[model samples]
Target: MTTRRTFMKGLAGGLAFCSCGMLDAASAQHHAPRRLPVMVSGKRIRTVDVHAHCLFHESLELMGDAVARILPPTKGQQEHFIVVENRLRSMDAMGIDMQVLSINPYWYGKDRDLSAKIVQINNEKLAELCASHPDRFAAFASLSLHHPDLAVQELEDAIKKKGLKGAAIGANVGGVDFANPKFHPVLAKAEELGATLFIHPYRLGELASRFKGNGWLANVVGNPLDTTIALQKLIFEGVLDKFPKLKVLSAHGGGYLPSYAPRSDHACFVSPQNCDPTIQLKKKPTEYLNQLYFDSLVFTPEALRHLVAQVGASQIMLGTDQPIPWEEHPVDHVFATESLNDSQKAAILGKNAAHLLDLKFS
Candidate 1:
């Protein structure tokens, strides 16, 4: 009979709240801060971050003179160059027990041979790093997605041999959308292998000019929009129907889709001409969300609650676009969601990720 409010009130004067120890976010910012573990209803919980970004130094070498083309070894890209112990400490402070490392694909435009070599090297480096700290890290394999045939083999080798969890993909490969049938073979392979494809949003490219002024809209607006377009293409073009079991998880709460997904449900009804009469979708546009998984990187309790409202909590998992510093306190972010019960909080923290990725931890 105990309500969630009183249950939270029963804990540490109702100030420590839901066990993430956020008691005072303001003061904690200035202080050394707490390295407390995440707990729900007095029980400790494991936290798995499915969206932490990383790039290997050796992989950068493949670019040679063109290394600066995409990432440029910026201060952000240099984060992993430090000792791994430092990263572990950062994870400890943030209450993350495990992170699934991923590298954003930059060689999507590179030639097939060069791109394949880059993927092979990066996947090896990722596997080595995960091998070093199996308890603290797992990784998604890098793939030469630009070439569908090579990607099929790369994914198999990375998962079957290298022991990676899955693969990280940009919203689009070069300018091509996932809906393009050319990539169907890779999607089919992923479904057959049950490999989760983590879709991290990337730059908007051609759309950058409009997002010019302040606020980094180029990223803030563009990245999520990129993901929205990618997901929509899969849904509207019948790609999801072709490969219903394809495991896809999108970063930043699957972009703006969840926010305005219902709007899409009415699109085919509102504008009959544009809705393709030849290809009928099996499910309502919004219903497609039920099959998709998303990272909890929306950045606010209310926002997360809304996302969960749209797509059940079972479809959400913890993520921090780490090293870039998008959501530093992801544990606190989960604990702060008033609408979630302790069970749901624990699931979002790590249980769901473990189930989805087949991860194991003591």
Candidate 2:
């Protein structure tokens, strides 16, 4: 495995000279003297990226040396996850004030003991990162949902003791959906604790055979598809109904479901047989869409506008799947969108997330 010293040497060796302004901009955002609540448009906007990621060196070491080979390389051949310099540079360039980091745990298939250890390592690192850089970084805890009881305890500790913002979870636990009664204990605990659940895709294992292509359709289509399915299960099965106070911030613009949610409402009306008779709902499926939240990672001004039109602006927050080069200029994306007014843009950029995350700017 590459040590931090070795990686820093590589960063210096292969890197070409950049403008001092850019370097200072990256270094200054966190360290520079400034008032709190980060003003924008002559008002306190406080831009926050609800979706960002990092990798801890200790966690990687625990996974062993061969695992490091699969990690993606950043622009300067730096390890994308372990190196913080590029992340800070990108955040500075994007004008993001604070980023909420999550690990998106890869230990779902590991044995319970190993998975628990991974969760502990990830949460501890996340806490340390947030503690060290309180201005620029906050984080969600990693959970081993296969063991729901353990997950509940871990989440409680992460929020109450470690000061993590919440928990980031895959769309499903193994093949089981979030709507499963078995998972309700964890969900109840999250709702009870007022934890924000960041639902990211696990990659579609069921669609593997059909997703064969050069375009990475498995992710392009399958990632959103998994999120869509997971969300539908929550909606159609009344999981959201059971926990109306639960704060769920869906990744990838709440998958394709928000844009296509009206179809779900129509389905139950047109094809009663297809709808589960046992599962009764008080509101239309699309109505439940408003009760949820989404990220502005749709990648187009028009797409962002449509999402706002579908679910209203207050339910959306800024999310850049950073370190992946997806939606690189998320702040600019919101600004370029013509449909949203200044107030709506401000809310999506930060205020909404501040309320959900209970962030208190100092």
Best by lDDT: 1
Cα lDDT computed for each candidate against the true fold: 0.83, 0.80
lDDT of 2 by residue, 104-172 (tens): 667777778887888999999889878877878888999989888889999999999999888999998
* Clashing pairs counted in every model: 0, 0
TM-score per model over all chains: 0.89, 0.87
Number of colliding residue pairs in model 1: 0
Predicted model with the maximum TM-score = 1
lDDT of 2: 0.80
RMSD list, candidates in order: 11.0, 5.5
